[model samples]
Target: MGVVSATARSDRYPKQDRSRATRQKLLEAAVACLAEHGWTGSTVTVVAERAGVSRGAAQHHFPTREDLFTAAVEYVAEQRSSALRELPAQDRRSVVAALVDLYTGPLFRAALHLWVAASHEEQLHARVTELEARVGRETHRIAVELLRADESVPGVRETVQGFLDMARGLGLANVLTDDRARRERVVEQWAGLLDGALGD
Candidate 1:
Protein backbone atom coordinates (compact mmCIF):
# COMPACT_ATOMS: atom_id res chain seq x y z
CA MET A 1 0.00 0.00 0.00
CA GLY A 2 1.17 3.53 -0.77
CA VAL A 3 1.61 5.95 2.12
CA VAL A 4 -0.68 8.95 1.80
CA SER A 5 0.24 12.45 2.94
CA ALA A 6 -2.06 14.44 5.27
CA THR A 7 -2.82 16.89 2.44
CA ALA A 8 -3.71 14.01 0.15
CA ARG A 9 -5.99 12.51 2.78
CA SER A 10 -7.75 15.84 3.25
CA ASP A 11 -8.16 16.11 -0.51
CA ARG A 12 -9.60 12.61 -0.60
CA TYR A 13 -12.54 13.89 1.41
CA PRO A 14 -14.72 16.84 0.44
CA LYS A 15 -13.40 19.94 2.28
CA GLN A 16 -14.48 22.84 0.05
CA ASP A 17 -17.80 24.65 -0.13
CA ARG A 18 -18.48 23.39 -3.65
CA SER A 19 -17.99 19.82 -2.52
CA ARG A 20 -20.23 20.48 0.45
CA ALA A 21 -22.87 21.84 -1.91
CA THR A 22 -22.74 18.64 -3.94
CA ARG A 23 -23.20 16.57 -0.80
CA GLN A 24 -26.16 18.73 0.23
CA LYS A 25 -27.70 18.27 -3.21
CA LEU A 26 -27.34 14.51 -2.94
CA LEU A 27 -28.93 14.60 0.52
CA GLU A 28 -31.81 16.74 -0.68
CA ALA A 29 -32.41 14.33 -3.54
CA ALA A 30 -32.39 11.43 -1.13
CA VAL A 31 -34.97 13.16 1.08
CA ALA A 32 -37.19 13.89 -1.90
CA CYS A 33 -36.93 10.28 -3.06
CA LEU A 34 -37.77 9.00 0.40
CA ALA A 35 -40.75 11.32 0.70
CA GLU A 36 -42.06 10.56 -2.77
CA HIS A 37 -41.22 6.85 -3.14
CA GLY A 38 -40.28 5.52 0.29
CA TRP A 39 -37.14 3.65 1.33
CA THR A 40 -36.62 0.94 -1.30
CA GLY A 41 -36.75 3.41 -4.19
CA SER A 42 -34.12 5.71 -2.69
CA THR A 43 -31.11 3.78 -3.97
CA VAL A 44 -27.72 5.49 -4.34
CA THR A 45 -27.93 5.44 -8.16
CA VAL A 46 -31.40 6.95 -8.11
CA VAL A 47 -30.27 9.61 -5.62
CA ALA A 48 -27.22 10.39 -7.79
CA GLU A 49 -29.42 10.85 -10.86
CA ARG A 50 -31.82 13.07 -8.96
CA ALA A 51 -28.93 15.10 -7.60
CA GLY A 52 -27.47 15.51 -11.13
CA VAL A 53 -24.17 14.06 -9.95
CA SER A 54 -22.20 11.13 -11.23
CA ARG A 55 -22.53 7.81 -9.40
CA GLY A 56 -18.81 7.90 -8.66
CA ALA A 57 -19.08 11.30 -7.03
CA ALA A 58 -22.09 10.21 -5.04
CA GLN A 59 -20.17 7.20 -3.79
CA HIS A 60 -17.24 9.43 -2.92
CA HIS A 61 -19.53 11.48 -0.71
CA PHE A 62 -21.42 8.55 0.75
CA PRO A 63 -19.97 5.10 0.25
CA THR A 64 -23.04 3.34 1.61
CA ARG A 65 -26.79 3.77 1.22
CA GLU A 66 -27.21 3.90 4.99
CA ASP A 67 -24.65 6.69 5.24
CA LEU A 68 -26.49 8.68 2.59
CA PHE A 69 -29.90 8.31 4.22
CA THR A 70 -28.53 8.97 7.70
CA ALA A 71 -27.00 12.18 6.45
CA ALA A 72 -30.23 12.99 4.65
CA VAL A 73 -32.06 12.75 7.97
CA GLU A 74 -29.60 15.13 9.59
CA TYR A 75 -29.91 17.54 6.66
CA VAL A 76 -33.68 17.57 6.87
CA ALA A 77 -33.60 18.14 10.62
CA GLU A 78 -31.16 21.01 10.25
CA GLN A 79 -33.25 22.60 7.54
CA ARG A 80 -36.37 22.32 9.65
CA SER A 81 -34.63 23.74 12.71
CA SER A 82 -33.27 26.70 10.74
CA ALA A 83 -36.66 27.50 9.26
CA LEU A 84 -38.33 27.27 12.65
CA ARG A 85 -35.74 29.57 14.14
CA GLU A 86 -36.47 32.26 11.56
CA LEU A 87 -40.23 32.25 12.03
CA PRO A 88 -41.34 35.86 11.83
CA ALA A 89 -43.25 37.51 14.62
CA GLN A 90 -46.83 36.47 14.09
CA ASP A 91 -50.08 35.98 15.95
CA ARG A 92 -49.99 33.01 18.33
CA ARG A 93 -52.80 31.35 16.38
CA SER A 94 -50.94 31.70 13.11
CA VAL A 95 -47.77 30.32 14.61
CA VAL A 96 -49.65 27.34 15.92
CA ALA A 97 -51.16 26.74 12.52
CA ALA A 98 -47.76 26.96 10.90
CA LEU A 99 -46.24 24.54 13.39
CA VAL A 100 -49.05 22.08 12.84
CA ASP A 101 -48.66 22.32 9.09
CA LEU A 102 -44.94 21.66 9.35
CA TYR A 103 -45.39 18.53 11.39
CA THR A 104 -47.86 17.28 8.81
CA GLY A 105 -45.72 18.01 5.77
CA PRO A 106 -43.03 16.47 3.56
CA LEU A 107 -40.14 16.47 6.05
CA PHE A 108 -42.16 14.52 8.57
CA ARG A 109 -43.33 12.15 5.85
CA ALA A 110 -39.78 11.44 4.72
CA ALA A 111 -38.77 10.81 8.32
CA LEU A 112 -41.77 8.55 8.79
CA HIS A 113 -40.56 6.37 5.95
CA LEU A 114 -37.19 5.97 7.60
CA TRP A 115 -38.87 5.20 10.92
CA VAL A 116 -40.94 2.41 9.39
CA ALA A 117 -37.92 0.97 7.61
CA ALA A 118 -35.97 1.16 10.85
CA SER A 119 -38.54 -1.02 12.51
CA HIS A 120 -37.06 -3.96 10.59
CA GLU A 121 -33.47 -2.88 9.94
CA GLU A 122 -31.07 -2.88 12.86
CA GLN A 123 -28.53 -0.47 11.40
CA LEU A 124 -31.19 2.00 10.37
CA HIS A 125 -32.86 1.61 13.75
CA ALA A 126 -29.73 2.74 15.54
CA ARG A 127 -29.17 5.75 13.31
CA VAL A 128 -32.81 6.77 13.48
CA THR A 129 -32.90 6.52 17.27
CA GLU A 130 -29.87 8.73 17.75
CA LEU A 131 -30.79 11.32 15.14
CA GLU A 132 -34.43 11.36 16.16
CA ALA A 133 -33.51 12.19 19.74
CA ARG A 134 -31.32 15.08 18.68
CA VAL A 135 -33.87 16.36 16.19
CA GLY A 136 -36.66 16.02 18.72
CA ARG A 137 -34.75 18.07 21.28
CA GLU A 138 -33.94 20.75 18.72
CA THR A 139 -37.57 20.91 17.66
CA HIS A 140 -38.73 21.27 21.24
CA ARG A 141 -36.24 24.06 21.82
CA ILE A 142 -37.41 25.91 18.74
CA ALA A 143 -41.04 25.54 19.72
CA VAL A 144 -40.41 26.91 23.17
CA GLU A 145 -38.44 29.81 21.75
CA LEU A 146 -41.07 30.66 19.17
CA LEU A 147 -43.85 30.51 21.72
CA ARG A 148 -41.88 32.38 24.37
CA ALA A 149 -43.50 30.11 26.88
CA ASP A 150 -42.16 29.72 30.40
CA GLU A 151 -41.41 26.08 30.89
CA SER A 152 -41.29 26.74 34.62
CA VAL A 153 -45.00 27.31 34.56
CA PRO A 154 -47.08 24.42 35.83
CA GLY A 155 -47.83 21.73 33.23
CA VAL A 156 -46.07 23.72 30.51
CA ARG A 157 -43.76 21.05 29.15
CA GLU A 158 -46.42 18.38 29.36
CA THR A 159 -48.88 20.53 27.48
CA VAL A 160 -46.36 21.21 24.76
CA GLN A 161 -45.54 17.53 24.51
CA GLY A 162 -49.22 16.73 24.26
CA PHE A 163 -49.67 19.10 21.36
CA LEU A 164 -46.72 17.54 19.54
CA ASP A 165 -48.03 14.04 20.10
CA MET A 166 -51.42 15.09 18.84
CA ALA A 167 -49.91 16.66 15.75
CA ARG A 168 -47.90 13.52 15.00
CA GLY A 169 -50.97 11.33 15.37
CA LEU A 170 -52.88 13.60 13.04
CA GLY A 171 -50.11 13.40 10.48
CA LEU A 172 -49.99 9.62 10.58
CA ALA A 173 -53.75 9.31 10.22
CA ASN A 174 -53.68 11.72 7.29
CA VAL A 175 -51.37 9.59 5.16
CA LEU A 176 -54.15 7.72 3.33
CA THR A 177 -57.12 9.89 4.02
CA ASP A 178 -58.62 13.18 2.93
CA ASP A 179 -59.28 14.87 6.25
CA ARG A 180 -58.39 18.44 5.41
CA ALA A 181 -61.60 19.92 6.77
CA ARG A 182 -61.34 18.08 10.05
CA ARG A 183 -57.66 18.74 10.26
CA GLU A 184 -58.20 22.45 9.94
CA ARG A 185 -60.81 22.40 12.66
CA VAL A 186 -58.59 20.38 14.93
CA VAL A 187 -55.66 22.73 14.39
CA GLU A 188 -57.75 25.74 15.21
CA GLN A 189 -59.14 24.11 18.34
CA TRP A 190 -55.71 23.06 19.48
CA ALA A 191 -54.29 26.49 18.76
CA GLY A 192 -56.86 28.03 21.05
CA LEU A 193 -56.06 25.53 23.77
CA LEU A 194 -52.35 26.18 23.47
CA ASP A 195 -52.80 29.94 23.55
CA GLY A 196 -54.87 29.67 26.68
CA ALA A 197 -52.34 27.43 28.32
CA LEU A 198 -49.54 29.86 27.52
CA GLY A 199 -51.52 32.67 29.26
CA ASP A 200 -51.75 34.54 25.99
Candidate 2:
Protein backbone atom coordinates (compact mmCIF):
# COMPACT_ATOMS: atom_id res chain seq x y z
CA MET A 1 0.00 0.00 0.00
CA GLY A 2 2.83 2.41 0.90
CA VAL A 3 4.66 1.69 -2.38
CA VAL A 4 1.46 2.21 -4.38
CA SER A 5 0.81 5.51 -2.59
CA ALA A 6 4.38 6.70 -3.24
CA THR A 7 4.12 5.81 -6.93
CA ALA A 8 0.89 7.80 -7.28
CA ARG A 9 2.34 10.84 -5.49
CA SER A 10 5.51 10.74 -7.58
CA ASP A 11 3.50 10.49 -10.78
CA ARG A 12 1.57 13.64 -9.85
CA TYR A 13 4.74 15.75 -9.54
CA PRO A 14 5.57 15.85 -13.25
CA LYS A 15 1.98 16.72 -14.13
CA GLN A 16 2.00 19.52 -11.58
CA ASP A 17 5.33 20.80 -12.91
CA ARG A 18 4.03 20.84 -16.48
CA SER A 19 0.91 22.71 -15.42
CA ARG A 20 3.03 25.35 -13.67
CA ALA A 21 5.24 25.73 -16.74
CA THR A 22 2.24 26.14 -19.01
CA ARG A 23 0.83 28.78 -16.69
CA GLN A 24 4.14 30.64 -16.69
CA LYS A 25 4.33 30.55 -20.47
CA LEU A 26 0.81 31.95 -20.72
CA LEU A 27 1.58 34.75 -18.29
CA GLU A 28 4.76 35.74 -20.14
CA ALA A 29 3.02 35.59 -23.51
CA ALA A 30 0.16 37.73 -22.21
CA VAL A 31 2.57 40.42 -21.02
CA ALA A 32 4.41 40.48 -24.32
CA CYS A 33 1.19 40.67 -26.31
CA LEU A 34 -0.23 43.43 -24.17
CA ALA A 35 2.99 45.43 -24.40
CA GLU A 36 3.25 45.16 -28.17
CA HIS A 37 -0.43 45.20 -29.18
CA GLY A 38 -2.19 46.98 -26.31
CA TRP A 39 -5.26 45.75 -24.48
CA THR A 40 -7.66 45.71 -27.44
CA GLY A 41 -5.46 43.49 -29.55
CA SER A 42 -4.35 41.09 -26.82
CA THR A 43 -6.98 38.40 -26.52
CA VAL A 44 -6.63 35.05 -24.78
CA THR A 45 -6.41 33.35 -28.14
CA VAL A 46 -3.61 35.67 -29.16
CA VAL A 47 -1.70 34.99 -25.97
CA ALA A 48 -2.28 31.27 -26.16
CA GLU A 49 -0.93 31.26 -29.69
CA ARG A 50 2.10 33.23 -28.60
CA ALA A 51 2.59 30.81 -25.71
CA GLY A 52 2.37 27.80 -28.00
CA VAL A 53 -0.44 26.36 -25.90
CA SER A 54 -4.00 25.51 -26.81
CA ARG A 55 -6.71 28.04 -25.96
CA GLY A 56 -8.23 25.51 -23.59
CA ALA A 57 -4.94 25.21 -21.72
CA ALA A 58 -4.68 28.96 -21.31
CA GLN A 59 -8.28 29.14 -20.14
CA HIS A 60 -7.64 26.32 -17.71
CA HIS A 61 -4.86 28.36 -16.12
CA PHE A 62 -6.72 31.68 -16.24
CA PRO A 63 -10.52 31.59 -16.30
CA THR A 64 -11.06 35.12 -17.66
CA ARG A 65 -9.11 37.68 -19.69
CA GLU A 66 -8.96 40.09 -16.81
CA ASP A 67 -7.74 37.37 -14.49
CA LEU A 68 -5.00 36.42 -16.94
CA PHE A 69 -3.70 39.98 -17.47
CA THR A 70 -3.88 41.05 -13.86
CA ALA A 71 -2.01 37.94 -12.80
CA ALA A 72 0.54 38.38 -15.60
CA VAL A 73 1.43 41.94 -14.62
CA GLU A 74 1.57 41.03 -10.96
CA TYR A 75 3.84 38.07 -11.65
CA VAL A 76 6.29 40.15 -13.69
CA ALA A 77 6.23 42.93 -11.15
CA GLU A 78 7.12 40.50 -8.38
CA GLN A 79 9.97 39.14 -10.49
CA ARG A 80 11.28 42.66 -11.08
CA SER A 81 11.02 43.44 -7.38
CA SER A 82 12.99 40.34 -6.54
CA ALA A 83 15.65 41.32 -9.06
CA LEU A 84 15.87 44.77 -7.48
CA ARG A 85 16.40 43.30 -4.05
CA GLU A 86 19.15 41.06 -5.37
CA LEU A 87 21.14 43.89 -6.95
CA PRO A 88 24.58 44.44 -5.50
CA ALA A 89 25.16 47.60 -3.50
CA GLN A 90 26.03 50.42 -5.81
CA ASP A 91 26.61 54.17 -5.87
CA ARG A 92 23.59 56.44 -5.60
CA ARG A 93 23.69 57.29 -9.30
CA SER A 94 23.76 53.63 -10.33
CA VAL A 95 20.91 52.85 -7.97
CA VAL A 96 18.87 55.74 -9.36
CA ALA A 97 19.48 54.53 -12.89
CA ALA A 98 18.40 51.02 -11.94
CA LEU A 99 15.14 52.27 -10.43
CA VAL A 100 14.40 54.35 -13.51
CA ASP A 101 15.16 51.40 -15.79
CA LEU A 102 12.45 49.43 -14.00
CA TYR A 103 9.79 51.75 -15.38
CA THR A 104 11.19 51.92 -18.91
CA GLY A 105 10.80 48.23 -19.75
CA PRO A 106 8.14 45.99 -21.28
CA LEU A 107 6.53 45.35 -17.91
CA PHE A 108 5.80 49.05 -17.55
CA ARG A 109 4.34 49.20 -21.04
CA ALA A 110 2.03 46.23 -20.36
CA ALA A 111 0.94 47.76 -17.07
CA LEU A 112 0.12 51.08 -18.73
CA HIS A 113 -2.20 49.31 -21.17
CA LEU A 114 -3.96 47.54 -18.32
CA TRP A 115 -4.36 50.83 -16.49
CA VAL A 116 -5.97 52.42 -19.53
CA ALA A 117 -8.31 49.48 -20.01
CA ALA A 118 -9.29 49.49 -16.36
CA SER A 119 -10.39 53.10 -16.60
CA HIS A 120 -13.08 52.22 -19.16
CA GLU A 121 -13.90 48.63 -18.17
CA GLU A 122 -15.90 48.58 -14.98
CA GLN A 123 -15.33 44.90 -14.28
CA LEU A 124 -11.54 45.28 -14.49
CA HIS A 125 -11.32 48.54 -12.56
CA ALA A 126 -11.35 47.27 -9.02
CA ARG A 127 -8.91 44.42 -9.58
CA VAL A 128 -6.41 46.54 -11.50
CA THR A 129 -6.73 49.36 -8.97
CA GLU A 130 -6.03 47.03 -6.08
CA LEU A 131 -3.17 45.39 -7.95
CA GLU A 132 -1.60 48.73 -8.79
CA ALA A 133 -1.85 49.86 -5.19
CA ARG A 134 -0.06 46.77 -3.96
CA VAL A 135 2.57 47.04 -6.71
CA GLY A 136 3.08 50.73 -5.95
CA ARG A 137 3.67 50.08 -2.28
CA GLU A 138 6.09 47.26 -3.00
CA THR A 139 7.99 49.39 -5.51
CA HIS A 140 8.22 52.23 -3.02
CA ARG A 141 9.55 49.93 -0.36
CA ILE A 142 12.12 48.53 -2.79
CA ALA A 143 13.19 52.02 -3.79
CA VAL A 144 13.75 53.01 -0.17
CA GLU A 145 15.77 49.90 0.52
CA LEU A 146 17.86 50.21 -2.64
CA LEU A 147 18.53 53.89 -2.04
CA ARG A 148 19.15 53.40 1.66
CA ALA A 149 17.00 56.41 2.29
CA ASP A 150 16.30 57.48 5.83
CA GLU A 151 12.55 57.99 5.59
CA SER A 152 12.37 59.25 9.18
CA VAL A 153 14.34 62.29 8.17
CA PRO A 154 12.29 65.28 7.17
CA GLY A 155 11.54 65.43 3.43
CA VAL A 156 13.42 62.21 2.69
CA ARG A 157 10.33 60.15 2.00
CA GLU A 158 8.97 62.83 -0.29
CA THR A 159 12.24 62.94 -2.14
CA VAL A 160 12.09 59.19 -2.81
CA GLN A 161 8.48 59.51 -4.01
CA GLY A 162 9.46 62.39 -6.25
CA PHE A 163 12.24 60.31 -7.76
CA LEU A 164 9.86 57.46 -8.52
CA ASP A 165 7.33 59.89 -10.00
CA MET A 166 10.03 61.32 -12.21
CA ALA A 167 11.05 57.84 -13.32
CA ARG A 168 7.43 57.04 -14.20
CA GLY A 169 7.16 60.24 -16.20
CA LEU A 170 10.25 59.26 -18.12
CA GLY A 171 8.66 55.91 -18.81
CA LEU A 172 5.56 57.55 -20.27
CA ALA A 173 7.73 59.74 -22.45
CA ASN A 174 9.65 56.72 -23.78
CA VAL A 175 6.42 55.12 -25.05
CA LEU A 176 6.39 57.61 -27.92
CA THR A 177 10.08 57.50 -28.82
CA ASP A 178 13.54 56.32 -27.84
CA ASP A 179 14.17 58.97 -25.19
CA ARG A 180 17.47 57.48 -23.99
CA ALA A 181 19.71 60.47 -24.75
CA ARG A 182 17.38 62.90 -23.00
CA ARG A 183 16.62 60.39 -20.26
CA GLU A 184 20.28 59.89 -19.37
CA ARG A 185 20.66 63.62 -18.79
CA VAL A 186 17.58 63.63 -16.62
CA VAL A 187 18.87 60.64 -14.69
CA GLU A 188 22.17 62.39 -14.03
CA GLN A 189 20.35 65.46 -12.76
CA TRP A 190 18.10 63.35 -10.55
CA ALA A 191 21.05 61.46 -9.16
CA GLY A 192 22.67 64.75 -8.16
CA LEU A 193 19.46 65.87 -6.56
CA LEU A 194 19.16 62.58 -4.70
CA ASP A 195 22.71 62.79 -3.44
CA GLY A 196 22.03 66.25 -2.09
CA ALA A 197 18.62 65.37 -0.67
CA LEU A 198 19.80 62.10 0.92
CA GLY A 199 23.06 63.09 2.53
CA ASP A 200 25.33 60.75 4.48
Candidate 3:
Protein backbone atom coordinates (compact mmCIF):
# COMPACT_ATOMS: atom_id res chain seq x y z
CA MET A 1 0.00 0.00 0.00
CA GLY A 2 1.12 3.54 -0.71
CA VAL A 3 1.72 5.82 2.26
CA VAL A 4 -0.89 8.57 2.57
CA SER A 5 -0.01 12.15 3.40
CA ALA A 6 -1.58 13.74 6.52
CA THR A 7 -2.64 16.81 4.51
CA ALA A 8 -4.42 14.66 1.93
CA ARG A 9 -6.28 12.78 4.67
CA SER A 10 -7.27 16.03 6.35
CA ASP A 11 -8.60 17.52 3.12
CA ARG A 12 -10.53 14.34 2.39
CA TYR A 13 -13.23 15.46 4.80
CA PRO A 14 -13.46 19.21 4.33
CA LYS A 15 -16.01 21.44 6.13
CA GLN A 16 -17.11 23.77 3.40
CA ASP A 17 -20.37 25.71 3.44
CA ARG A 18 -21.15 25.36 -0.28
CA SER A 19 -20.72 21.60 -0.16
CA ARG A 20 -22.98 21.42 2.87
CA ALA A 21 -25.67 23.47 1.13
CA THR A 22 -25.55 21.24 -1.93
CA ARG A 23 -25.79 18.15 0.23
CA GLN A 24 -28.76 19.59 2.18
CA LYS A 25 -30.61 20.43 -1.03
CA LEU A 26 -29.98 16.99 -2.40
CA LEU A 27 -31.18 15.34 0.78
CA GLU A 28 -34.31 17.50 0.97
CA ALA A 29 -35.17 16.82 -2.65
CA ALA A 30 -34.68 13.11 -2.13
CA VAL A 31 -37.07 13.12 0.83
CA ALA A 32 -39.68 15.07 -1.08
CA CYS A 33 -39.48 12.77 -4.09
CA LEU A 34 -39.38 9.60 -2.00
CA ALA A 35 -42.43 10.71 -0.02
CA GLU A 36 -44.44 11.95 -3.00
CA HIS A 37 -43.47 9.64 -5.82
CA GLY A 38 -41.59 6.69 -4.29
CA TRP A 39 -38.25 5.11 -5.26
CA THR A 40 -39.08 3.94 -8.76
CA GLY A 41 -40.89 7.14 -9.60
CA SER A 42 -38.30 9.37 -7.93
CA THR A 43 -35.70 9.10 -10.64
CA VAL A 44 -32.45 11.04 -10.53
CA THR A 45 -33.93 13.47 -13.06
CA VAL A 46 -36.88 14.18 -10.85
CA VAL A 47 -34.71 14.58 -7.77
CA ALA A 48 -32.41 16.93 -9.64
CA GLU A 49 -35.34 18.97 -10.85
CA ARG A 50 -36.70 19.12 -7.33
CA ALA A 51 -33.34 20.23 -5.99
CA GLY A 52 -32.88 22.82 -8.76
CA VAL A 53 -29.75 21.09 -9.89
CA SER A 54 -28.72 19.15 -12.99
CA ARG A 55 -29.07 15.39 -13.05
CA GLY A 56 -25.30 15.20 -13.43
CA ALA A 57 -24.92 17.26 -10.28
CA ALA A 58 -27.11 14.89 -8.33
CA GLN A 59 -25.16 11.92 -9.62
CA HIS A 60 -21.86 13.59 -8.81
CA HIS A 61 -23.02 14.27 -5.28
CA PHE A 62 -24.31 10.74 -4.83
CA PRO A 63 -22.68 8.15 -7.06
CA THR A 64 -25.34 5.51 -6.49
CA ARG A 65 -29.09 5.32 -5.82
CA GLU A 66 -28.28 3.83 -2.41
CA ASP A 67 -26.30 6.89 -1.39
CA LEU A 68 -29.14 9.24 -2.24
CA PHE A 69 -31.75 7.11 -0.48
CA THR A 70 -29.51 6.76 2.56
CA ALA A 71 -29.20 10.53 2.85
CA ALA A 72 -32.96 10.94 2.47
CA VAL A 73 -33.70 8.34 5.13
CA GLU A 74 -31.16 9.88 7.46
CA TYR A 75 -32.77 13.28 6.94
CA VAL A 76 -36.22 11.86 7.66
CA ALA A 77 -34.99 9.88 10.66
CA GLU A 78 -33.38 12.98 12.18
CA GLN A 79 -36.73 14.75 12.21
CA ARG A 80 -38.06 12.18 14.69
CA SER A 81 -34.71 11.88 16.46
CA SER A 82 -34.89 15.46 17.74
CA ALA A 83 -37.72 14.50 20.10
CA LEU A 84 -35.51 12.01 21.91
CA ARG A 85 -32.29 14.04 21.69
CA GLU A 86 -33.17 15.95 24.83
CA LEU A 87 -34.91 13.93 27.47
CA PRO A 88 -38.59 14.84 27.70
CA ALA A 89 -39.70 16.16 31.07
CA GLN A 90 -42.63 13.92 31.90
CA ASP A 91 -43.63 10.80 33.76
CA ARG A 92 -42.92 7.48 32.08
CA ARG A 93 -46.55 7.14 31.01
CA SER A 94 -46.57 10.57 29.36
CA VAL A 95 -43.21 9.91 27.82
CA VAL A 96 -44.38 6.65 26.39
CA ALA A 97 -47.43 8.42 25.04
CA ALA A 98 -45.21 10.95 23.27
CA LEU A 99 -43.13 8.15 21.83
CA VAL A 100 -46.28 6.54 20.53
CA ASP A 101 -47.34 9.82 18.99
CA LEU A 102 -44.07 9.93 17.11
CA TYR A 103 -44.63 6.41 15.84
CA THR A 104 -47.98 7.29 14.31
CA GLY A 105 -46.91 10.68 13.06
CA PRO A 106 -45.50 12.16 9.83
CA LEU A 107 -42.10 10.64 10.41
CA PHE A 108 -43.69 7.23 10.37
CA ARG A 109 -45.23 8.02 7.00
CA ALA A 110 -41.83 9.01 5.65
CA ALA A 111 -40.34 5.79 7.00
CA LEU A 112 -43.08 3.72 5.45
CA HIS A 113 -42.30 5.33 2.13
CA LEU A 114 -38.66 4.55 2.65
CA TRP A 115 -39.53 0.98 3.56
CA VAL A 116 -41.56 0.59 0.38
CA ALA A 117 -38.65 1.93 -1.64
CA ALA A 118 -36.31 -0.46 0.10
CA SER A 119 -38.56 -3.42 -0.49
CA HIS A 120 -38.37 -3.00 -4.27
CA GLU A 121 -34.98 -1.41 -4.81
CA GLU A 122 -31.97 -3.51 -3.94
CA GLN A 123 -29.72 -0.48 -3.83
CA LEU A 124 -31.94 1.26 -1.27
CA HIS A 125 -32.50 -1.71 0.99
CA ALA A 126 -29.42 -1.22 3.15
CA ARG A 127 -30.08 2.50 3.42
CA VAL A 128 -33.58 1.97 4.76
CA THR A 129 -32.34 -0.75 7.11
CA GLU A 130 -29.81 1.72 8.48
CA LEU A 131 -32.58 4.23 9.12
CA GLU A 132 -34.58 1.64 11.10
CA ALA A 133 -31.50 0.52 12.97
CA ARG A 134 -31.07 4.13 14.05
CA VAL A 135 -34.45 4.06 15.81
CA GLY A 136 -33.64 0.67 17.27
CA ARG A 137 -30.35 2.01 18.61
CA GLU A 138 -31.93 5.07 20.18
CA THR A 139 -34.98 3.54 21.94
CA HIS A 140 -34.55 -0.18 22.34
CA ARG A 141 -31.73 -0.28 24.89
CA ILE A 142 -33.45 1.93 27.44
CA ALA A 143 -36.80 0.22 26.98
CA VAL A 144 -35.29 -3.21 27.55
CA GLU A 145 -33.39 -2.12 30.67
CA LEU A 146 -36.39 -0.34 32.16
CA LEU A 147 -38.68 -3.28 31.55
CA ARG A 148 -36.07 -5.58 33.15
CA ALA A 149 -36.27 -7.53 29.94
CA ASP A 150 -33.30 -9.61 28.94
CA GLU A 151 -31.08 -8.37 26.12
CA SER A 152 -31.15 -11.80 24.53
CA VAL A 153 -34.90 -12.04 24.46
CA PRO A 154 -36.20 -14.38 21.77
CA GLY A 155 -36.59 -12.83 18.27
CA VAL A 156 -35.79 -9.39 19.68
CA ARG A 157 -33.30 -7.21 21.46
CA GLU A 158 -34.90 -7.56 24.85
CA THR A 159 -37.62 -5.24 26.14
CA VAL A 160 -36.82 -2.17 24.10
CA GLN A 161 -36.56 -4.03 20.82
CA GLY A 162 -39.84 -5.84 21.44
CA PHE A 163 -41.66 -2.58 22.15
CA LEU A 164 -40.07 -0.77 19.20
CA ASP A 165 -40.94 -3.61 16.86
CA MET A 166 -44.50 -3.49 18.02
CA ALA A 167 -44.47 0.28 17.73
CA ARG A 168 -43.28 0.11 14.11
CA GLY A 169 -45.80 -2.56 13.23
CA LEU A 170 -48.53 -0.50 14.79
CA GLY A 171 -47.40 2.62 12.97
CA LEU A 172 -47.73 0.87 9.63
CA ALA A 173 -50.98 -0.68 10.66
CA ASN A 174 -52.43 2.66 11.70
CA VAL A 175 -51.32 4.17 8.41
CA LEU A 176 -52.96 1.43 6.43
CA THR A 177 -56.10 1.60 8.53
CA ASP A 178 -56.06 5.44 8.77
CA ASP A 179 -57.28 5.14 12.35
CA ARG A 180 -55.74 7.67 14.73
CA ALA A 181 -57.88 7.50 17.86
CA ARG A 182 -57.88 3.73 17.79
CA ARG A 183 -54.11 3.72 17.50
CA GLU A 184 -53.69 6.01 20.49
CA ARG A 185 -56.00 3.69 22.35
CA VAL A 186 -53.69 0.84 21.40
CA VAL A 187 -50.76 2.87 22.66
CA GLU A 188 -52.57 3.37 25.93
CA GLN A 189 -53.04 -0.34 26.17
CA TRP A 190 -49.35 -1.05 25.53
CA ALA A 191 -48.44 1.62 28.04
CA GLY A 192 -50.49 -0.38 30.51
CA LEU A 193 -48.63 -3.49 29.41
CA LEU A 194 -45.29 -1.90 30.17
CA ASP A 195 -46.76 -0.54 33.37
CA GLY A 196 -47.48 -4.08 34.37
CA ALA A 197 -43.78 -4.87 33.99
CA LEU A 198 -42.81 -1.85 36.11
CA GLY A 199 -44.71 -2.99 39.21
CA ASP A 200 -47.54 -0.55 38.61
Cα lDDT of all candidates, in order? 0.85, 0.96, 0.69
Q: What is the C-alpha RMSD of each candidate to the true structure, in Å?
A: 4.7, 0.9, 5.4
In the range 19-74, model 3's lDDT, one tens digit per residue, is: 77777898887877776675667667788888888888789888877778677767
Q: In model 2, where do residues sit more than 4 Å from their true spots? A: none
- What are the TM-scores, per candidate, against the unseen true structure? 0.88, 0.98, 0.73
lDDT (Cα, tens digit) per residue for candidate 2, span 1-200:
69999999899999999999999999999999999999999999999999999999999999999999999999999999999999999999999999999999999999999999999999899999999999999999999988999999999999999999999999999998999999999999989989999998
Error of 1 at 90 (Å): 1.9
* lDDT of prediction 1: 0.85
Ranking by TM-score: 2, 1, 3
Instruction: Estimate the lDDT of model 3.
Output: 0.69
Pitting candidate 1 against candidate 2, the one with the higher TM-score is: 2
* Model 3 regions more than 4 Å off: 1-15, 142-157
What does candidate 3 score on TM? 0.73
